[model samples]
Target: MRMRPLGRTGLEVSELCLGTMTFGTQTPPEDAHAQMERARKAGVNFLDTAEMYPVNPVRAETVGRSEEIIGDWFAKTGRRGEWIVATKHSGEGLKAVRDGAPISSKTIPETVEGSLRRLRTDVIDLYQFHWPNRGSYMFRQNWRYDPSGQDRAETIAHMEDALEALERQVEKGNIRFFGLSNESAWGTCQWLRLAEERGRPRVQTIQNEYSLLCRLYDTDLAELSANEDVHLLPFSPLGAGFLTGKYQGGAVPEGSRMSLNAGMGGRKSPRVFEAVAAYLEIASRFGLDPVQMALAWAARRPFVASAIFGATTLAQLEHALGAAEVTLSDELLEAIDEAHRDHPMPY
Candidate 1:
């Protein structure tokens, strides 16, 4: 796996990050460990997880179980510092986390302490806020998103408060660098401006959904990333299993994400299948595995620091890792461009 620099921190991360949100829920502990070992062998030195993980069926009791799994892995392997460990603090709206409250000045320190205990580490390499407290367009909220009533001054105050809390975490040695997720370019600029004004550490990376099907980060976020040196840690780079051609004939394929949430969180639609098929056909024409094409496309994006991906089983993990070596050619990319032009905003 190739390594990429994470912003201006001088920290090198793997091009493909091993995502562990499936750890305690869809996957058993042993299998999770096995997948970690496989990823390590493959030279992937970055691991990403979050506090409210194992999220397919997020439950109050199993909220922090994913971190516990990682802690166990570190304890058993005794190689805690061999790789870069990145995790996030859950923002408001998730019922099981912090009583479903938003992140604030009072919450950061305690959240850092809890994450440290569960991760079996004294420090986190990259600490990220799962989303903004004042809310932004993400998780398919774009459909009904309206920023007309938002108070810019109040939002900046919250951003500054959050930055102060993050700065405190940095001073306490709990978190080295901070990141943003599900954020817009304007929101990112607000955080950077606040940090610079206060002489605090600016946000470094962004974790947003970017895939063949979802190009939300392409225009504005791409500019922000390239210009500000903010890196992209794209999650669900496969379009939540749609780009893999698994749901082509309307088959949910037992135990897939579709089996649990049939709507795939509003991602499933009439146009989505045609878009998936078009990309699949291009991959086949180029003699490429659709999964490989999907992953490679995300990884090769100019501003992408790393693509975050997860697998439910060992076989699935192996299939995803295989994409690490495939490189998309100009012909394949042109075909994909044509497909995109023919069908934009499928969902």
Candidate 2:
């Protein structure tokens, strides 16, 4: 696996990050450990998780179980130092954590302590805010997203408070770097600007949804990432299993993500399957495994630091690891671009 610079934090991460949201839910503990071992052998040293994880059906009782599983792996192998672990602090609108309280000065310290205990690590290599407190356009919320009512002055104050809390964590050696997820370009610019003015840690990365069917990051976020040095850590590069062709033709295999969340987290639409079909046809023409093709395509983007991928089984993990070595030709890439043009924002 090729390593890329994680902003200016003086740390490099693998091109592919092992995402662990499936831990303690879809995957058992032993299998989760085995997946990590396989990823380590493949030279994928980065691991990503969230505080409210195991999230097909996120519940209060199961919150943090994913982190606990990763902690167990560290304890079992005594190899905690080998991986660059990244996890998130849950934001507002999620009752599973802190009673749906938004991330603020009062919540950051306690959230950090909880993650540290569950992850069995002294310091988080990359600590991320799961979402913006004001709300986000992610998770198919872009259809009716309106931000005109937000108070700019209040938002700036909240950011300053959060940055102060993060500065304290930096002083105590609890975290090495900071990142964002499901955030807008404007919000990222504010964080960067504020951090510079206040001498706090700069934003290192942003995790957002990017796939064959979802190119939300292609315009503004892409430019911000390239010019500002905040890398894009794209989650769900496979489009919630749509790009993999598993859910094609209305086939929802047993124990599949679609079976649990029937709407596939609001990704269900008439145009989605059409988009998936086009990409699947491209994979067939190129004689490439669809899963590998989807992942390799997303990884080839200029601003991507690492593509975070999740797997519920060892076989799926092994299948996805092949993408670390797959390379697409110029003709194949052009074909994909055409496909995107033909089917933009299918969801």
Candidate 3:
């Protein structure tokens, strides 16, 4: 529950951000409220959600339900100012929202307004574009990613247009800062360049997947984050609960994510289980909870602003909260590095 600065925004956020992707779907409204209260009690002041949320099976009908649940909590507790809330505008290919509209000048205002209405908040602490309109290498796309079809000038124009709209949001007090998700180093650089040149809101954070199983950000993006002060808000630090050792030995517990989505969003693989076993062994040897080890490892990274984690139940949330106290020793970190070397990119 340690607080950290969110990029250069001067807004401090908890080291662990409570994720609400399951708030209204797998998790009921009352449970979601209890989770929020529990997290607040644990000193977590940051929450992350999106317009297209409650996503075990993201549905058009359930769209924005997670934010609505959070809004209800805010209304009931009257504690909106106690936390820094971050949410995303769905990008292209999310058919449930705006008919799969790409984020652009026209979409920014309405999307921000919609999120505000659902969250019962006036100004968003961090408004993130869920992904680039052109596309991204995240979500297992790196295996077949190709950028040859991209139009550089067109992409730059889109960035400029989106930044302009975001600047207007800043002026009108709709959003205080802007961020990106599922973006690449080059894409982030362009956003930073445009903001510097135009004096728009700086890209404060990059909320990408980073964990023991996913080290995609350890190279260029890590350097970019360190040098530019655009810290990372790593989502899925537990590898979608795979790192929690729940999916081991092919045991698909009922009501689990793997039970709902058999593939776990392409994360289930022979190599992945091997990687999980290796990390789990390390945790067992060190007498640590695997969930806390994985989350603490992600939070300990130099470029991480916060590690975003989701829990489907209060017990799961309490388990993750223990990570705040589980500090990895230098020897344990080295063991994790050794395991990574042995099983890199398991998924």
Candidate 4:
């Protein structure tokens, strides 16, 4: 596995990040530990989870269980320092956590404290906002997304205050760096601008959905990443298992994500299957496993820091790790671009 710089933080992370949102939910603690072990053995040094995780359903009862599972693994194996752990503070609209409170200066310290306790770590390597408090266009919210309700002055004030709070965490050695998720290009620029003006921690990365079926990050976010050195940690590079051809024929495998979340986190549109079929056909034409094909494609993007992926079974993870060695030829790249043009924005 190749290691890349995590922005300007002086931290090097694996090109592939293991996502633990499935831990303690569809996956048990023992299995979760085994998965981490397998990922570590495969040279994946980055592990990502959130406070409100184990999130196929994301119930209040299971919130924070994923981090706890990882923490237990750290205790059992004494390998906590071996991995660069990343976790998130839940934004507004998650009623199961913080009573749907938005992340702000008032909540940053307490949120960091809870994550530190659950993770059994003195310092979180990368602490991120799970989503923007103002709202975001990710997760298929783009079609109906509206920015008219935002108050510019209030938003800037919240960002400045939050930066101060994050600075405090850095001073106390509670967090090494800060990041964002489900954020837009404009919001990212604002955060960067404020950080420069106030000498605070800059947003190092943005975790957003990027896949053959969802190319939302290929345009504006792509430019920001190139110029600002804020790279992308793209989740769902497999299109939530769609690119694997498992759900191509309307076949929802018994334990798949679609079976659990029904909507597959806003990726279950009618046109999505068709898009998956196109990518699957490309993989088939090149004699490649669709899973690795999709992952490798995302990993090769110019602005990607790491490609975050989740798997319910060990076999799935092992298969995904094979992407590290499978390089796409120039022909395959052209074919993928053609496919994207044929079927853009499935959801």
Backbone N/Cα/C clashes per model: 0, 0, 0, 0
Write one digit per residue (lDDT tens) for candidate 2, span 1-347: 88888887888889999999999999999999999999999999999999999898999999999999999999888999999999999999899898999999899999999999999889999999999999999999999999999999999999999999999999999999999999999999999999999998899999999988899999999999989999999999999998888888889999999999999889998899998999999999999999999998887789998999999999999999999888899989999999999999988
The global Cα lDDT (0 to 1) of model 4 is 0.92
Instruction: Give, for candidate 4, the lowest lDDT window spanning 10 residues.
Output: 261-270
Question: What Cα-based lDDT does every candidate model obtain?
Answer: 0.90, 0.93, 0.95, 0.92
Q: Between prediction 1 and prediction 4, which has the larger lDDT? A: 4
Model number with the top lDDT: 3
Indicate the TM-score of model 3: 0.99
Tens digit of per-residue lDDT, candidate 3, span 14-52: 899999999998999999999999999999999999999
Cα lDDT tens digits, model 1, 1-347, are: 88899988998888889999889988999999999999999988999999998888899999889999999999998999887999998998888998978888988888899999999998999999999887878888898999998998988888888888888889989999999999999999888888889998888999998898888898988998999999999999999999989998979899889999989999999899999999988988999999878988898899999899899999998998988899878888899988988988677
Please, what are the lDDT tens digits per residue for candidate 4 over residues 66-117? Answer: 9999999888888899999999999999999989998888899998999999
Off by over 4 Å in 4: none
Model 3 is weakest, by summed lDDT over 10 consecutive residues, at 241-250
Models, CA RMSD each: 0.9, 0.7, 0.6, 0.9
Ranked by TM-score, the better of candidates 2 and 4 is: 2
Tell me the spans in candidate 1 whose CA falls farther than 4 Å from its real position: none
